[model samples]
Target chain A: MLSVVILGTGNVAFHLAKVLSSNNSVELLQVYGRNKTKLQAFEPFCDTTDNLGKLAAAAIYLVAVSDGAITALTQQLAGLDGVVAHTSGAVSLEVIDHPRPGVFYPLQTFTRDKKIPFAEVPICLEARHPNDLRLLAQLAGKLSGAVHRIDSAQRRQLHLAAIWVNNFTNHLLYIGQQLCEEKGLSFSLLQPLIQETVDKIQQLSPKEAQTGPARRRDVQTIQTHLDILEAPLQKKIYQLLSESIKSTYEKEL
Target chain B: MLSVVILGTGNVAFHLAKVLSSNNSVELLQVYGRNKTKLQAFEPFCDTTDNLGKLAAAAIYLVAVSDGAITALTQQLAGLDGVVAHTSGAVSLEVIDHPRPGVFYPLQTFTRDKKIPFAEVPICLEARHPNDLRLLAQLAGKLSGAVHRIDSAQRRQLHLAAIWVNNFTNHLLYIGQQLCEEKGLSFSLLQPLIQETVDKIQQLSPKEAQTGPARRRDVQTIQTHLDILEAPLQKKIYQLLSESIKSTYEKEL
Candidate 1:
């Protein structure tokens, strides 16, 4: 059985602790957090403590803290003889101040209230030694269906892509919701269309799946849409994205 | 039964024809398309015509052509007793020259090969008279679970919002896919995260759902991400969106 100890009490930490504690082939030895109240949520599932010096012996020490806290937290585990790893997409594995530092980044968003099924999440692993990489992969395999040994550079690129797909895309949806609210239309009306847009990508590449006035270069409709948008930021965004879409298609043609 | 004659053989027309013909309360009288080869796809299921002059008489003439073609198609049915309607989100109702003009816009993207169940699609209806609106709504209700009475102004606004959510969101996915390809990572690795992003918005408002380096105002990670992106356009987009997200949360604070 793979023994693991998780640090931090954030969304990622909470989720990792729950999944590690529940897995049949894994033993979650302890969970460490700075805030006592936040650590309480992990207490019922496993041994919990606010003191990093009191960390138990485990095969792996998984740091699931914020990017800023990761380095300092890893520093506190200087004496631990385990494969030290941080669960971050953007942060590099070099942040871990240990001889056997590694990464166990799960490329999925975690919310405190939402219980995500660990099986479908892709676990990206990295390590300095072959044995440590294999050990990390083995533990990740137990909790997830997919795992990859990605370097710090590739992981950083993946994190950037994640922001584009998740952060930027959600922002567009927010803009759409605002427009709906101002025009007295239910935002729910656009849900099916949004779903279909994602669905199309499953069958066709996003380039092939693209459709709209922008893709067709409908100048009249584009002008009309620009006229309708009252917000300067919204108009600028609309114009820029529309131009981008048009250029993407224009290159293909 | 409400008799309907569908014009055009595009994605919208193809899907609408299939759904209307299947509904017991609606009789899909005929389908018209300028191209004979495209019309053949609809021939096996219902009557297909290349000549608009041979258009059958029905209670509603649904013009499901491109936005530019809507006016001309509606003019072809000028003297028909049916309630003439164009299925367009951006085009105003005044484009339909008929005295009894209406709209039967289904607010979902349609692809020819992908068979979308009409029951989940939201149909937006508008008309010159209340009776025509009711007639269009009744037919729309048979095929869809949700129907809304939206005027030309509201429909235009909804169309603009659709561009933001559907078109712009898809483009972001395209950008993400490109980055994944460049880094030798499978784009599928990001799918679960993308799904979670949308799922979160379903429960929380998009504003509340927003989370990322930008939303947290993590300038260090933001700059790191921007540095990782080599493309000038990609960098510009990242900066603009990150600023937008930062400003959005700053306002809330």
Candidate 2:
């Protein structure tokens, strides 16, 4: 059985603890957090501690902290025999400052209120030593069905992609909501269209799935749309994205 | 029973025919298309006619043609006593020269290959006369669970929102795919993250659902991401979107 101790009380840490504790093949030893109230959620599941020095000995120390705090937090876990790993997509594994530095990044967006299914999330692992990598892979397999061996550089790229697909996409939806509200229309009316857009990409590549006035190069409609947008930022975004789509298809056509 | 004749053989026309034909209260009298080969798909379900003069008499003549073709197509059905309606989100009802001009737009993306459930798709109806509006709403209700009486101005706004939610979001996914291909990573790894992002919005407002380095105003990570992106367009989009997100939360905070 692989013993794991998760450090931090953020969304990533909370989710990792839940998945690890549920797996029969893994033993979740303790959860360490600086905030007492935040650590209360993990108290019922396992041993909880605010003091870093009282961290339990485990096969692996999973540091699920913020990007700014990761390096400083890892420095505090010095002289530990267990492999030290951070669950960050952007931060490099080299920031661990340990002989057995590694990464156990789960490529997913986690919300505190929403419970994500562990088996579906892709877990990306990296380590310098073969034994450390094998152990991380084994633990990742228990938590998720999809496990990939990705280096720090590749992980950083994947994280950048995540921002586009998740962060930017959400912001676009926010803009859509604002547009709807301005015209006294219900945002719910566009839900089916939004869902179908995502569903199409599952079967066809995004390039093939693209469709709009911009893709068709309908100049009149594009001009009309630009004229309708009230916000300067929205107008700029619409122009840039439309130009990008037109250029992308122009090469193929 | 309401007899309806459909015009054109594009994705919108084909999907609308399927749903209307399935409803017991509606009779799909005939399908008119200029292309003989494309009209074959509807031959088994209804009478197919390439000649506009051969159009069968019906209570409603639904013109499901391209935006540019709608005006000319509606003019062709000039003498028909039926209520003439076009299924376009962008086009105004004023384009239909018929005395009983109307619109029966389904607010969802229709692909030729994919069959969408009619019950889940919202149907937006508009007409000049109350009787025509009632008849259109009745037909729309038979095909969909959600029906709304939207005027031309409001429908145009909804169409603009559709572009942001569907077209622009798809472009963002395309950008994400490009980044993944550059780093030799599978795009499938980001699918779960994409799914979660949409699912969260169902429960929370899109404004509340936003999360990332930009939302937190983490300049260090945002700059690192910008430095990593090679394409000028990609970098510009990243910076612009990040700035938008930062500005949005700055007001809220």
Candidate 3:
């Protein structure tokens, strides 16, 4: 069994600690965070440390601190005798500055309350040393069925694309919720549609699966939708996205 | 059993015809479309018709025609002896006129090859008369577990929102796929993140459920992501969406 230390108590750190603790191949070593209360949440399964010097005890230290805290945390761990890594998709490896550094960024969304099934989650791994990379890959494989070694450049692209698919798409749902309330329509009606939109992508290409006024190139329908959406910003977004979809289908708009 | 005349051969019409034809309560009277080849796909379970006048024999005429064709199809069905409606979420009910007009908006993403369980799909019903509304609602209920009396205003909003959540989001995935190809990574690696994103909405509100660089106000991560985006348009979208997400959490951005 391999031992690991997690440094941070945010959503990702909490979930990662919970997952790593439950696995038989992994031993929970210690948790490091500044907030004593937050640090106490993980004391049930492992020892606690608020100092960076204590993190040197573990073979693998996960720097699960915030992006701002990551620089200072890694700076403090610059002399640590272990494989230090950050759980960030966009942050570069140089941010670690630690002698033995890598990335163990999980490419799945994590909420404090939502328990994600690791069987379906994808873990993105990157490390300079072949041995350390193999260790991260093996450890990730234990937690999830799928694991990939993606470099900083690829992970950056993935993170941006996630913005489009997850964050942007979700904001759109929020807009729909607001629109539904105004029209006295229940937001529940659109839930199934949202789920299916995502499900269709599993089998069909997005370009081929797209269906709507813009996909149909129905100017009348587009005009009507714009008329209904009186908000200037909403109308702009609708137009930009509609044109984008049309261009994707090789249609002259 | 109620008789129905399905008037189109596209994805929506195809799926609707298939679901209705499979049920014991629906007596599929005829399947009509301008193209014989498209109508041929549904020939086994329906009596295919190309002429508009031939469609007057059924109790309900479902005009699953394109948004642009809805008006023309309704004009053709003016003298028909049955209730006429279209499956467009954004099209107004007035396209088919008052006394016999209706809207049968199946609020779900439909793919020609992927068979969706219509029982879980939401059906939005709207009609002129109380009797017609009830008839449509009952018919919709037979095929789906949930049915709602959604008007043109509300349905249009739902359609607009789907554009943001589905079309735009999928485009984002396409961008990610492009990014993966450039960096020698498989887009399939993103499937877990995509699935978890949709799953998250089940429990938390999209606003309350958002994660990533923007929510955390991690400008370094955002700047790194923006620098790595190969396409200029992609970067602009990334900037705008990140700004939007940031505005949601922090007003100072």
Clashing pairs in 3: none
C-alpha TM-score for every candidate: 0.95, 0.95, 0.94
Model 1 is docked with a DockQ of 0.75
Better of 2 and 3 by lDDT: 2
Q: What is the DockQ of each candidate?
A: 0.75, 0.79, 0.63
For candidate 3, lDDT tens digit of each residue in B132-201? 8887887898899888888887787777766666666666666666676777777787787778777887
Model 2, position A204, has a per-residue lDDT of 86
Worst 10 residues of 1 chain B by lDDT: B109-118
What is chain B's TM-score across the candidates, in the order shown? 0.95, 0.95, 0.95
Query: Residues A101-139, candidate 3, lDDT per residue (tens digit)?
Result: 899988878888889898877788888898889888878
- Candidate 2 regions off by >4 Å? none
Which parts of model 1 are misplaced by more than 4 Å? none
- TM-score of the second chain, cand. 1: 0.95
Looking at the true structure's interface, with contacts defined as alpha carbon pairs within 8 Å between chains A and B, what fraction does model 1 recover?
0.72
Scored against the true structure, residue A24 in model 1 reaches a CA lDDT of 85
Question: Model 2, DockQ value?
Answer: 0.79
For each candidate, report what fraction of the true interface contacts it reproduces: 0.72, 0.79, 0.61
Model 2 chain B poorest ten-residue lDDT run = B109-118
Reference-based lDDT, residue A18, model 1: 89
- For all candidates in order, the CA lDDT equals 0.88, 0.90, 0.79
Question: Where does the lowest 10-residue lDDT sum fall in candidate 1 chain A?
Answer: A109-118
